[model samples]
Target: MVRWQVNLTVLWLGQFLVMGGMTMIVPFLPLYLQELGMKDPHEVATWAGLIFAGNFVTSFLFQPIWGGLADRYGRKVMLLRSGFGMAIVMTLMGFAGNAWQLLILRMVNGTISGYAPAAVALMSTNTPKEKMGFAMGTLQSGAVAGTILGPFIGGLLAEWIGYRYIFYITGILLFAASVLTLLLVKEKFNVKEASAKPKISVIQAFGQLRHVRQLPSLYGVTLLIQFAMLSTMPLMPLFVAELHGQTAGLAFFAGLVGSITGFSNMFASPILGKLSDRIGPERILGICLAGAAVLFIPQAFVHNVWQLFAARFGLGIFMGGLLPTVNALIRKYTPEGMESRSYSFNTSALSLGNMLGPVVGGAISGYFNIREIFILSTILLFINSLWVYKTLLVRKTSIEVNFEDERPR
Candidate 1:
């Protein structure tokens, strides 16, 4: 048990470091593009949206492919590959001469962004069923911590030196993470199974969606939860700018908002996760959904930076529980062999939300006021929370009944 715990801890640490390094680039990317000759606000905004959307588009498209490969080959190998590939791509991004080059590199980075999925697969496979929630929650805390620290540090570096340096530093850190993964992660490859006929086709691989459909309420609730959670994302920078009126360093203010949210996630995620373990993931999830909705509504009204910070911090507390609870609920519904597929599908849903959230936010902000964007987000979240309660919490169907209902009558 101790050995297993140690192994999990190491994997978690590797994930934390990699995520920290990778996300650090996000807050600085727009500023970097501006420095690289695109000075127009509209151009910078468009490029920023493209950069953000591009990552998710590629990630969503390739996640299932990586999952299938992991199932066939091994999870650890995929982890190493993802880390190494991401490191190289991220480094090359630093040398990009134009916005187009940087956009291409971002797409490449997204294509190889399987480290977290791989790590989750590896950890879930090894962890005891009884302690799965606890373990996953603990792992999530580490990643959140990285997100909290990354932006602040990256923003500072970008301000003091240059934005390109942020990418270089992130690349080096990712490379170091890859090295650590290669050295420490151990997988028992199945020689006999490797020689056998392939068990699943790429199309058949997508058949895993059937499993999720069996738990429609769970799946729907999860999707809504993610949609609600991410709806506020694109407007964050704009919101910060409004709060920090006349601020000299807009990049720093953006970083400050990112860091505050991260800090809240860092502190709140584990506690909510542990609470989920104690009280139950479903109840915790429902409560978080409602709480986040309430908190986020107030964000649209904040007049000062400190007020925005407080609202975001409060929202982060409840929002932090969402992913872990969703994971736990999905685990409860999915079978062992299908866990990887289930997680991959969940990730794809998140990617879809990532794609839609920004587009929705950007569109709303483009035509209407940014504050209206938050109001719309609040409405979406409220609807999402109610949907979760009605679909998952209120329904008391067995897995088999749910499955049967989802099939042809």
Candidate 2:
């Protein structure tokens, strides 16, 4: 295979391992807290929430710093740094004596977590521009597939090998991914050229608006896409329970409902990505956003779990198109020499969305019906679609016309 294709394949695997290992322990956090001697159920719940969100909070703050460094040095070194750092932190979590230790370790894990973003930066610079959507989409599929399977595998492994051992296994997997990247992934970063370029301070990294006009808006798009999709996730089990009634198979059905979107997403992302490559990422993004917004409305009205399942499946097909297209556009608009910084800032936006979506969803569910969250997501996504069309598509058309007018004839 050619070099970019090779980079994509290896990085896809690395992303899979990173995301899967990270997510594996998420479902079992409360249980793990209990094992750590937190007997009070309320205490366990609070600790679990703190431990889980701790990672994203630090990750959101630190990603841009890492991105700046990645541009100054190289994305491959940053990838290895996150991979190895996380592996060590995850391994130590297996030995944490108390909830506080675990929480601190989790926060550290988040602080060092940039493997996926670094992978994206490396791939973005290396891949051909025309194939960028496919690269982003295919890479996203790895993470989605990992997210879908990680919880299930973690649940089973928790049952069989126990919870602490799960951490050990996760550490091993992360180490393996880093080793693979160290040996295989080829990044043609020019050391002399990168050293000669002006250093990107954290402020300079985020202060990219002066350089790239579409960047801040694109960051907003990334944040909103993540926020809209994840906002409904926390309420899913309760919603499933309400729909399915108090049945013994309720957990099974809820798991299915939670994961079915990923099934379709894993398949749809690459397909939509290729379509975007042929047509234009801007238009594909708007089409997918509108479609997802419409799908969310039906989900709010679904009377049964099966109907919700179908709605989520359809929503997945559209959701698959959103991020890859956004990444493609980010690449198209980003200044040269700042590719890593741009993608890293986008990662920070994504981390913010991941942190806030559940909190907002929970608050809305508390004040209103769980179904209202879907309506809220629908409205937000629809607004985002309109914004994309006005900012990206219309702007593209005007620029093209202006270019044609200026061309020598």
Candidate 3:
């Protein structure tokens, strides 16, 4: 097997464990908050949101720094740094004495976590261009699988061993992932290539945006895609409750309803990703964008839980294509050896959208209704489709070095 094949396999497993361990906390967050001394329901709810948001805020801030370091030192180093750092932080979070300590630790976890994107960088640099889509798609499936399974497993474990032990277990899983990466992952980083270029400062990194083709709008699409996907997340359970009018199995149904998209997405991402490699990522992105836009509209009009679930599952099929294709495009356009920074910037843009999506979803749902959130996201995605057409499809990029030629035929 080629080096990239081995690397992809290791990275895939690492991403699965990291994402699974991280998201496992979501199922028990409110309960954990209560255990941390938050008594009132309102207070617990607010703190839970705050703790979740805190992680994203810091992650958004710190990703590029780690990415830049990956370019200079090695992507594998960044992977291990993120994985082990998060393990330590997560373990500490299990022992928090108060909400403040937990909040701070969550922020720390966000600040340190970058293993997924770091893995992406490593894969992007190592994989043959002809197989880039398949690698990214397969990697995306790992993350989606983790997201799909994490909460269910966590919920079961939380019941069996309690929330605090779940945190410890999560920490252990992350540590194991880091160790796997250390033992199995390989990097072909040349130190001189990074040092040969003028040392670019963080502010200078923003200036180097010119290195990417369609910089503004590519990043814009990244932000828009993430925003559209997450816009309904914060209110999903509430929407499910309203749909069924306070049913006894509301919690189970709500969780299932929310996860259906991920379920479909988990399967669809790799398939669409491989397809994108054949037809061009731009075309794949355009198709998925239009499909998602149309699918989201049905979500607003759903009269029953099953209808809503169907709409979300359909949306997931399209949603699965968006990020992997976009990243593939980003890889195609980015300057050689700067893949880490570019992916990091993309991650930061997506993370920003994540932080804002829930806020926008909350505002729209608060003012008009949960249904309106779907409507607004539909409009945004439609506009985004037009943007994708103009920026990615119509415009001819300057840096068109075909990577397939670099690969051994």
| Residue ranges of candidate 1 with Cα displaced over 4 Å | 34-41, 187-198, 214-226, 237-244, 247-254, 301-303, 366-368, 394-409
Q: lDDT: which candidate is best?
A: 2
What is the lDDT, from 0 to 100, of the residue 25 in candidate 1? 77
Error of 3 at 13 (Å): 1.1
Taking the tens digit of each residue's C-alpha lDDT, what string does model 1 give over 269-327? Answer: 76887777787777888898788778877877888888887987888888778777777
As a whole number from 0 to 100, the lDDT of residue 172 in candidate 2 is 98
User: Which TM-score value belongs to model 2?
Assistant: 0.98
Q: Best by TM-score, which number?
A: 2
Instruction: Report the Cα lDDT for residue 125, model 2.
Output: 90
Worst 10 residues of 2 by lDDT: 204-213
CA-only RMSD, every prediction: 4.6, 1.1, 3.5
Q: Over all chains combined, what TM-score does candidate 3 have?
A: 0.94
Judged by lDDT against the true structure, how good is candidate 2?
0.89
Query: Please, what is the whole-model Cα lDDT of each candidate in the order they appear?
Result: 0.75, 0.89, 0.87
Per-candidate clashes come to 0, 0, 0
Cα-based TM-score, every candidate: 0.85, 0.98, 0.94
Instruction: Tell me how far the alpha carbon of residue 153 in candidate 3 is from the true structure, in angstroms, after superposition.
Output: 1.2
